[model samples]
Target: MLTQLTISNFAIVKQLELDWRNGMTTITGETGAGKSIAIDALGLCLGDRAVTNVVRPNTKKADLSATFDIKKNKPANTWLSQHDLEGDDECILRRVISSEGRSKAYINGSPVPLTQLKELGRLLINIHGQHDHQLIVKASEQRRLLDNYAKHQNLIDDVSYYAKKWAELTNELERLQTSQAQREAEQQLLQYQVKELDEFSICEGEFETLENDYKKFSNSQSILEDTLTTLELACDNEQFNILDSLRQCVDRLIQYSDIDGDLANVSTIYQDALIQLEDASNDLRHFHERLELDPQQFQVIEERYSNAINLARKHQVSPESLHIKHQELLQALANISGDDSRQEQIFVELDKTKIDYLEAAKRLSDSRSKAAGEISQLITSSIQELNMPHGQFKAHVSTKEGEQLSSHGLDDITFLVSINPGQALEAMHKVASGGELSRISLAMQVILADKVTSPALIFDEVDVGISGPTASMVGDKLKQLAKTTQVICVTHLPQVACKGHQQYFVAKLTDGEHTETTVTELSEQARVKEIARLLAGDKISEHSLANASELLAS
Candidate 1:
């Protein structure tokens, strides 16, 4: 339920605040008295597009806000919690439009996007303007209204889910089929590359080891000669061998050790040097014996190294990266094979999805067919009471063969009407006048009000082109609707205004330089006088006042 609306700096309304209650509230005013200004301001708070001209003459911006009590509105409360903008029992939607055409929206004091504001507003209120009757002519809108009345949302959701799945799988299958030839051509090249790489069997770090071995084999002769020369110098050479010289130095130092203890340390060092030189000679002999100068082994090592370098160049990678490239090629070949298997699986899934969509669509169609007949009968009976004595309404539900799966199912619905007896029924847009259309729209609204989730309904000038007993009937229907939901109507008809539990009067006030609109809640006596003015137009005679009194009394 909408609790309050506040407007500031809006066109013709400098500042206004309205507190609303849950009942039938009627707004009455003369021609050009800004009766609809409040409705327009409320629309702004409900995320309607704002224009710069809506701002007051000298104001920089226009501000509007609507407060809704959502304690009993589960959909609205869930929406607020989902968006992280929940309020304490009250949700306030605020909008600001600047003179420069910039705008901002907020929910519960937290900034939000306009789309989210619009989404939340839909759950809060339903506004039907005089122009909304034009929507009766649109086929899509007709289907929507029927579905809403039917309350088959669960079946519709199933159809939508399956249809979406079907589309996805179909698209994937088409893509795979289109690329089949290209994938097959690439498969041959990938297979050849994988085979070649597998035969190479490159190991990590083996390339560097192989290169080192090749260098050692190539330098074997020089290495062997160098080791023999070092051995001769250390011990094998008979003249001036290193070990013999070290032993003579050790003998002299040992003799001096009897005179001084420091000489004993020096003798120990020379003896250790002799032992180290002998060990070095032994190692040199071992190395010389192990060294091989085989030309055949060297050629084999050279060829292997060359082949590795050539393969690296051919693959456009370093010798170290050969193994990584090989693995990648193998994976690519595996994916191509996997795609063939996946294509078959997708085909199977698509067939299943199509079946599911058809089943759901069939269920939805059946439910809609049943609901359409019931709603059409109810609306036909309702319009007759609204002064259309011979009015007839029908919800024509037909099926289109070979139609593709859609979110709304495969039913084509159109509303047909006949306004005269013995006349054939034609499309509503072709047969009904504007006034008749308004009545039909009203009848439909009355029939669907209980099924609707919106807590509040606003009718703007819905009584246009209606008066006398018909106006009273319209008023009675609105009042009846208010029994289940809050209804606010802007009307000029005294019959309609008199039926409201609460009445408000709108008038324009001017202060020489500026014009503004003001609204005032009418007292009982004031209400009678206003109705009298509405009856007599600017002059309230005694008879008009008496008539107004009688109208109120009834």
Candidate 2:
């Protein structure tokens, strides 16, 4: 429910604030008095396009805001919570347009994108302007309305889900079939590569170890000669052997040890040196005995090292990464082989999904067919009461042949009507005049009032081209709709204004230099005079006043 609306410097509305209540609230004024300014302001707050010209001539910007009570509106409350914009029990939507043509939107005082504001606005209010009558001409809009009336939202969702799944599977199968021959040739190449890699069976760190062994085998003779030379210098040579000289020096130092403490220290040092030289000679002799050159082992080590380097280059990878590359190739091969099997499985699933989609669509179509009859009867009865006594209304639901599955199912729905006895029923847009279309729209809304979840409905000029008894009937229908939800109507008919539980009068005020539009909530006497003015065209006579009173009384 819209609880309040505020407009500042918007068009001719200098500053205005109006409090609203549930039930029918009628707005009336003379022509050019800006009766529709309130509706326009509401549109601005509901994310309508803003223009600089809408700002008051002397003002730099226009501010518009609307407050909605959503404590009982589950869909609106859910939307607020989902978008992280939930406030107390009320939601405030605000929009501001600067003279430079820039605009900003806010929800609950927090800035939001324009699209978010529009989405939430749709859930909170339904404004049925005179132009909305043209929407009946669209086939898609017709489908939407029929589905909404039938409450087939869940079925519609299922059809959408399955349709998307079917498209995905079909595309995958097509792609696989297109590349079947190329994949077969690639599979043979992968097999040969796998076999060759398995033959080498390379282990981590094997390349480095092979290179080390090859180095040792190729330099065996040089290693043996070097070790033997080192041994002769340390202890193996017969002349001037280091170990023998050190032993003789130690014996000479021991003879003087009793006479001199320094000589005893020197003898200990020489003895330690002789022992180290003897150990070094023994190690060299052992190394020389082990250094035997084997040509066959050398040849094997060289061949393995060369093979590793060449293969690493061939695969465009370092020797250390060869193992990882092998695993990657194996995975690629497995995926290519798996595609054929996966394609067959997808075909099976695609068939099942198509069946599911068709079954769901059929159920929806049946429900629509049943609902068409009931809706047509209800609307036909409603329009007759609105003064179209000879009118015939039908909800035409027909199956679309050879149509691919879609989110809206397979039914093409259109509303057909005829306002005379001899005329055949034709599409509502082609057959109904502007006035008849308004009445027809009103009838449909009256029948579907309970089904609509929007908390507020605004009817702008729905009584256009309608007057006399038919105008009164339109007023009564709007009043009936207000019983379940808030109804705000901008009307020029005295009968409709008299039917309102509350009445507001819009008028233009001028201060010589400027003109501004103002709204006044009418008291009993004020409402009577306004209604009289509507009836008498700016000259309220005694008869008009009395008529207004009687209309209000009724």
Candidate 3:
């Protein structure tokens, strides 16, 4: 339900803030009092196309915003959750249109696209104006209304799931059918590549180890010469050898050990150094013996390294990535091997899914067909009470070989009506009088009241062509709907406005030379004055006030 609306610099409405209550709220004022502007502002907030002309002539921008209570609207909350928005019970939607043809939309102060605003609008309010009355006549729209009325959540879910699967299968079939030559060429190339790779029998890490060995073997001669020279100077050379010098120093230190306590420690260090040099010399001699040069081994190493490098370059990958490419080619080969079986499986599954989905859809259609009869009877009874004694209303459900199924079903549903006796029933849009359409709209709402999820239903002059007893009944019907859902209406009829739990009056006023529009919620006394004015003229006569008071009391 809409809790509040604030409009600024929009057409004739300079600034207006309306606090709306739950249940039926009626807005009434004189003609040209900017009532349409108020509705237009609501439409703009609901993502209607914006025009700079709708803004006040001298203003930079026009702003329209409203707050809605979604405590009872679970569908809207789920939609919000899907969009990654916090689903508070209260939601505020705001829109601003600039004179420069720029518009901004926001939900709960966070900026959003107009598309999102429109999506949220569908869940929040359903405004049935003249255009909407015409929409009721369309068969597709009728089907949607019936589905909504029936609250077929499971059927809707199943149809959507199957429709997506059907679409995917159709796309896959097209790809496979149309790309046959290209796929064959790709398969041929992949087969040749896989055969070449399989003959190699390559192992992971082998390339890196081979390269390391090649580097060591290539530098072995230079390495051996350097290490041997160092070892000779350190131990093998007779006079200048460090190990010989260390032995002489140890001999002198042992003699001085009796004179100094630390001399023995120095002698032990020299002895350890001599032992380490001897072990190093022995290891260097073994390394020199092992460093034999082999041209054949070097050639083998280089040839293997070149093959790895050439393959890496040919494939536009590092030698390390050869393994991954090998696996990918093998997987592609497997896919090609199972291509026929996969296609057959998809075809079989597609047929089975279509059958399953059609069964569910048929079940839904059968239920709707039964419900349609009941709906026709219910609406006819409701409309007859509204003074359309000769009115004939019917729900026509037709099934054809549809091109595709929709979220609703494969069948088409339309509302048929005949205004006069002996007249053949036609589509609902063909109805001429505004009064009849309002009655029909009311009848549909009455029948669908239980299944529609909108917390608030707003009627913008839906009672336009109705008057007298019919107007009073429309008001009563709106009041009845208010028990389950909030109902708001804009009307010129005092009877319609009188039935509201809350009443608002939009009036044009002049502040100095400027003209603006203002809306005020009427108190009981104020309502009497307003209703009396609506009954009579600008002057509220005593009799009119009495009549108004009587109407309110009743």
In candidate 3, which residue pairs get closer than 3 Å at backbone N, Cα or C atoms, i.e. clash? none
TM-score of 2: 0.76
Please give the RMSD of candidate 1 to the true structure: 7.0
Candidate that would win on TM-score: 3
RMSD of each: 7.0, 7.3, 4.5
User: Worst 10-residue stretch by lDDT in candidate 1?
Assistant: 399-408
lDDT of each: 0.90, 0.88, 0.82
Which 10-residue window of candidate 3 scores lowest in summed lDDT?
130-139
C-alpha lDDT (0 to 100) for residue 137 of candidate 3:
62
Best by the lDDT measure: 1
User: Of the pair 2 and 3, which is ahead by TM-score?
Assistant: 3
Task: Give the clashing pairs for model 2.
Answer: none
> Can you tell me which runs of candidate 3 are displaced by over 4 Å?
1-17, 36-130, 238-289, 402-408, 431-435, 510-515, 536-554
Residue 546 of model 3, lDDT score:
98
Candidate 3 has an lDDT of: 0.82
